[model samples]
Target chain A: MRSRALALPMAAVLALSACTGALSDTGSLLGRDTLRIGVKADQPGLGLRGPSGEFTGFDVDVALDIAERLGVEPADVEFVEVTSAEREEALREGRVDMVVATYSITPARKTEVTFAGPYYVAHQDILVRADERSIDDVRDLAGRRLCQGEGSNSATRVIGERGVAARLIEAPTYSECVTMLEEGEVDAVSTDDLILAGFLLRSRDAFRIVNAPFTDEKYGVGVAEGDLSGCEAVNRAITDMYQDGTAEALLRMWFGDTGLDLVTSVPQFEGCS
Target chain B: MTAEAPPRPDRPTARSRAAERARRAAGRTTVRVWTLTAACLVGIAVLFAVTTGAIAQARDGFQVIGHGAGPKVAATADLYFALSDMDAQVANVLLMGDEHDLGAGREEALRRYEQRRDDADSALLHAAQLAEGDDAEQENVRAVLDGLGDYEQLVAEARLLNDEAGGGAGQPPAAVVDRYREATDLMRLELLPKAYNLTLESGATVRATYEDRRSATRLGPVWVALSGAAAAGALIALQLYLSARFRRRYNPALVVATAGVVGLVGLATLMLDDQAQQLRTAKEDGLDSVLALSRARAISTNMNADQSRWLLDPERADTYAQGFLEDAQTVLYVEDAAGEVPGDLAGYGAEVDDAVTERGGYRGRMLGFLGEEVRDAPLAGQAAAQQEVLRAYDGFLRADRDMRLIAESGREREAVSAHMGGAGSVEDAFDRYEEALIELTDLHRDTFDEAVRAGDDGAAGWDVLLPAACLAFAVLVLAGVRPRLAEYR
Candidate 1:
């Protein structure tokens, strides 16, 4: 009787256990031979979808490098589309094995998901139409209709703390805001300088960065929360890529011809510390 | 009177008496038949008039309310939003500099702007469709469309000049600002006023629909009542004549026919009453809200243009500033002929007043940054320029509180970055002040969309419901009179 009673409880416990999926643990990426990465599909040089339905961008290159570090082949890595708002949720829900979509590293975000190396620093800058002369700098943007990517704090910080009098419009993605600027829907689009440069590369002679950069944004790889081992592994890959001149090579390959501020060395890692 | 007496039965002369009796019976039959025919014919005529008149009234009402008022109001709102959206897009395009051939984000902005232009085009088409036959209305809509295209071209020219002047330069040339000013002036003085006039014309159209609906319903009941009363009077007269001639209590056929006419009159009146009341409610709540919201939106757009003009033309800064104040007064306060504040908004009204004062404080600070001697003329008799320069420098010195004290300040990029939010820079501070003014404009805009939506919802199903009611009354009149006509048969 006791054995039968124990069997019933055991079956019940087993059923409960079967219903719950496991969280991604530290260094667990290697267990699966194929890696799934969430990337921005619209950021031109950072992470973008090209013709022939292929993903190509600097962020794609970095993800390929990290996958190679994990002993996974570049062809085996699948890229999932992630928007700015969905990045954190996508990581928590196991929608992606990792993310390398020009994700910014922040101390507050560290509490939700672990960040690996900050491979790049993109300063906050403004993108205006080719014909705008009233706005020479951030100050000239006063009362202008300036659009920013939704969920980005670049415009918010300027409006909140700096007191820039710009009229802020939020779009779902950087691409939409960029389109608005190109068509003259909004006055300026403000975000990372390098991201804007990527836009400039895509749209010829229609736009340029007007004012100097205002804030520094460090880009990092996003992993599951508390996955320190996975974060560390990605950081190691970044470090090796830098040491072997591969990181600089990729940077030159993607942005050397553009007006972006190119860097030869890897950015100082945020370390998730 | 009893003039002749009949002969006795079963006599040879009784044949003559039989003939006289037969002739008298025939005469009585003829009288009864003619009276019944007259009553029935009059009843049928009145019923026909009531049904056809009601139907005609409903048709006219529906044509005005459904095809004219409803769609025209929607068209006006679309035009207003489209113009406002286009103006904002122009500003946005100017802000994003030369984002072609390699620029990503600004190009996205350009696409968004094109989408807005498409929206405006669609709105124009819709307005044209609403006003299909009227030459004046069509001409007016075309004017707005042409004006919009011109405005876009001007904006493009401005963008081109601004891009050429950029050339990786430190500041944009004065010519760039001038081009932007021209574009803005086109929007404000020419394009915006045309849009406003279109809205007013649409408002007039909307008013006509309501007036037509009201007048249509008003006359319908009176005609129904008048025709009904005449039919009843004819039937009653027939009844009295029949009662006297035949010595009967009442004619059942004529009574039923009279009651049918009365029923039709009541039904038409009731239906008309419901229609008029509902139509009135829709007009007051729905159409009035649209008018108020349109006015509010025009004010906000005007303010936006004024602000842009102020930044683009330093020489006309004071003029633009005064214009902003006047527009702000109109937007914030509901004034009468003498410019007296009428507290129509109750508690929500205070926000405008507060925003105005807040804007004033920021404007004072910003005008100084723009080198307003009136604002930044720090107490100096012979040294106004010296004191103002010293004060500006001091403000910058205190600006970068947490920033590192310039480790060999030769890097132009880093120095600019470090001084972005610095104290004495006053750049960000000016932005803060401008933000408040924008907030003031936003407060007015937020309520406009809701008003339009509420008005639209309230006005729904009016045309169908009213016409359906009229048809129902017609059926009720036909049903009530059919039984009376059958009794006559």
Candidate 2:
């Protein structure tokens, strides 16, 4: 009789464990028919949320492909605008199912949320005015004004880690940084090469990106913390996107005209752990 | 006397001594009379100078403050309104999409936009002229003009894209929307704020000048009265001395001289007092109301643009709605005591409607331009005109709510149509409101013009009359004492 009672308790414990396993960090996302993907709204060719309530860009297309593989239609996907600072918060609050914005994967961020794949690796570069001849490299930014977009560590990385000693000027976004550069308010803007390339498409004669590369910014798909299934799903979808040649096509469509070397092969995925 | 005259030495005589004493007395009397006459003439001269100077100052104030910066500042107000309307027309044109005949249509919208642009340019020119001496203001004007150029380019690009997309009966494609967003953002962020700053700087100047000029005008009467009293007093004193010394009840010339001095001084005092009153009317009843109404018109125009923006872009509808509510609050804020007021048009509409329905009449719970207009109606019929404005404004609020409701219920085209179309639309209601406001503004403007004209008239002829009166007063003073002095001779 004691064995019988113990077996019943053991069965209940096993059932509860199974239930807990099923309800994961991404339970809300995978179970839902619609996927809400966070994206940048102002970035011209990366993930610009256009005026007619539609999203277009490399990040946007990548997000849609991942959503499609996860059994969500393009029409069922909703694009939520997120800044670099709010990506983690948006995932934590379930405001977005996944963030496919230009979110870079790092050890510090990995502790907060699970990153799926590098998807694309972009190097940090400097953008200066067309007439600028003094600044050709990251090291040359010493004592010159550099734009620091809000919630971005690019300017600080150049000034702090690289020991550039550049005077940091602040703006809310990369778009404003470009405006400031055009207005001669700032000497240079440093960020991911892809973002600069997007802006360079508009006014090639006004601004030129300095080809000097510094830091490697591994762009990742962010899901909620401990959402191992969601992370694996995104990584698999990203691999398919590359294998099916959709990645190269989307990159060509958005950033082909810009003279940046396009990397089309499947990027090494960050571990779902 | 006979004994005195009997034996007179050749050296001295009593009659000769008496004659010498009489001659000395007559000389002293003549000198005293002349001295009093000169004092009276000096008093009259002071009165003339003070009166004429005050009048001249009043006339100068009217020319400089009333006609100079006053109209220029008013032009700035027009610029603010025109900038807002231009943006509104842009939104309306986009809302028309591929269809050209929707509501007032794209062509009509474009025509209005062009007209507003021209108006804006004209205003900028005026602002530039007004800002000629101020380097900082001149820089601001240049910046605004540059910003406007950029804004227009963006708008033109948006229109071209919209036409190319040919999206039927709704919002154009994403590209067009993005371009339009960029244009509107430029207008709102850079252009509108800078324009408003120009207005504020110019408005402050107007207010400061009004205060200075008004104070000068107000104190004019007191100064004139004091000098006039001195002149009249001196004249009366001279007349009394002449009458008593000459052993006559009155000297006709001196009496006439005293009357003339009192009459002229009284006339000068009355003229100054009336001019002061007119200036006060101009500032308090006119310019203040005109400024408030101008701000109201500009804000309402922006609010209407927000409505069109809400319809044009569904993605940012809530943002535009929030902006509309904020601007609406600025135009007419109703105070809520319970702290339960929601920060949305729904809640605000309820509050305003409830206030309007209150039986005891407007309990002064309302604030903002509208409230100020009603509370401070200085002229006759102004209060009634303000009431009509309030009524028309209520109609506009209702129409806006209805348009939003239709849009929310998935009838966006109907909503857009109602916004841009004929009678009973939001446009119609807004037009009514604007008309009422314009009527009230005209009343104030008319008062200002009248005050300026009357103020000029009050000081008229005083320049020549002052010197002429002074000269005549001097002549009359000489004439009044001439006979008395001749007695001593």
Candidate 3:
């Protein structure tokens, strides 16, 4: 009797243990459906929203293509607006399926999420007023003020470097930084050259970006870590895009004549740290 | 021993000894049952707590994933975009310095150059505001800005001299242009890298954030499984003790306790499985999609901005425009294509067609503007044509209203036509392309936003559900164990 009584619960516990294996087959949890992404709203030629409220830019086009390859229809994929500080948390907590808002790949970020493909390469630079005097080299503005977007790496680089002592002003976006410069609230703005070019184009007569790159930045797509299959898939898509003419066509469509040497060759996976 | 046996004849020793043994066994059974019950209850409670915690964490992780990806992505995107623009501006200023005449056109170029500089200044300020890194980058940018101001003053003086010479019709004053070129070259080669370094540093931080999120997502399920296993183990032990104590095969309370443990474990396992899957999908599919989009966009934007800046400098405008096109075609197009054409290849094809048409029209305008000068020396003509092309392009670009109209209508063909019409002057083409590119960028932004919203919707409510489930499972397990304890009493 004692053995029989023990047997029942023991069997049940074993049965429950067996069910644990069911947890291992996690495939069904991700239903077959479209994934939504969030990107920048105002970046020119990259992720700008049209007056008709249609999303179209180099980034948007690439993201759509990725969705289609994932079996998501064009109408199925949605978009959300996100700023600089919000991208990582969003991806970690599952707010968005993906983020294509000019994210870069780096060793530090590899700790949190998986990344795939350097779809585009960029660098940082400085912009100054066309007629401004007394500022030319990085060392020339030692005691002056500089503007950058809040939560931007540019701000940290500027603030962290040795032998430089400039007041830092923060803004939410590159455009706002331009406004600050226009309003004389800061001395200089540091960010990616492409964005500054947009500002210069818009301002027409108010600013010019210094024609030298301060750093190399390669933009990558971010996903939750250990999603090797998804990472591989995205990597493949990007690689395919590079080989085909689609990337070029999109580039021409968005950036009429910006001089960026987009690399056509596939990028090798330098394992993420 | 024989004497003792004789004495025990009246005592019934064997039967008494057997009975005492039975009673002691029964007492031991009772104690074991009570102890087992208590252990089971405690195990169940811990399991519940752990499961609940895991669920809660999973949910929180999901929310963080869903909500946090945007800003970091945006910051990096903006940084790249700004840097690309600054590079173009620097290049343009240098090219402008090569011109012998600082006439109205040259002055206009200078003004545009100044504006680009201003924009760069603003971008730095914006970067600083974000506080992503240390303070040194801000200082470096400031120093560069200051140096650029000094250079600008020198360039302005040179411009004055050239302008004066142009008005007087004497030997062209090339000295000022030379000085301006020298200053620009110095800044471009030296100070610019400081800013680039800053961007690189920030990129590191953004990448780190991505990694942190990835690990958290992956670890969530393991926690749940462990907790569930622990709970199940305790319940089984309790059931064994209860069975021994009562000599009964069926213990309803023990059975209930076992069932509750199973249920809790099962629920936790399922929830964990689901959460893991979602996180995996996000990691695998989502990150790269975002990166590719951003890279393509950044490159494209850089190309557009550079093209426009080239138009501002007529003398070397064609060279710059050609350079811009080459870069765009190579980086933005072929690289982004990867391999097979996307489903929406038509849109890309249309865009390419429009670009080609625009380029052709720009070439024709350059030829027209150059007239005889272009014919005298083909190389000179090419140079002259490039300058003329740029001017026509600028004119086209500046006509924002027409470009906006074409963009609003989604009439790629019409837009191309309008762009060609405006390409009679470099200035014209510049205006049209600028408007067109801006419109295209806007469209992409909307598309990205929609994708984000969909992702968010799919992942919602996990945070609250996880903790609640854990807590409930614990309560059920404890309740089931309580009846077994009462039976012991």
Residue B123 accuracy (lDDT) in model 3: 56
Candidate-wise lDDT, in order: 0.59, 0.78, 0.52
Which ranges in model 2 have alpha carbons more than 4 Å from their true place?
A: A1-273, B1-17, B337-342, B359-364, B376-378
- TM-scores computed on chain B for all candidates: 0.61, 0.93, 0.56
lDDT tens digits, residue span A37-114, model 2: 999988888888767878888899888888998899999999999987899999999899899999988645766888
Deviation in Å, model 2, residue B70 alpha carbon: 1.7
Q: What TM-score does structure 3 among the candidates reach?
A: 0.43
lDDT of 3 by residue, B1-489 (tens): 111122344665788888666756656665665565556556656665666666655555555444553334444444444545444444333333334232224455455556656666665665565444544445544555676667667656755665555432112235644664565444433344344433433444444444454444455445455555555566666656556555657656456656756775666566566665555444333433344334433454455544434333334433344345433333323111233211122332333334334543422211111121223322212344334433333343344335435534765334323432334433354544444433333333444454445444544564575456545545555565556545544
> What value of lDDT does candidate 2 attain over all alpha carbons?
0.78
Interface RMSD of 1: 32.9
iRMSD, per candidate, in listed order: 32.9, 36.1, 17.3
- DockQ for every model comes to 0.01, 0.01, 0.02
- The number of the candidate with the highest lDDT is 2
Instruction: Please give fnat for model 2.
Output: 0.00
Give candidate 1 misplaced runs (Cα > 4 Å). Answer: A1-273, B1-29, B32-36, B67-69, B96-112, B130-137, B167-171, B251-254, B329-351, B354-489
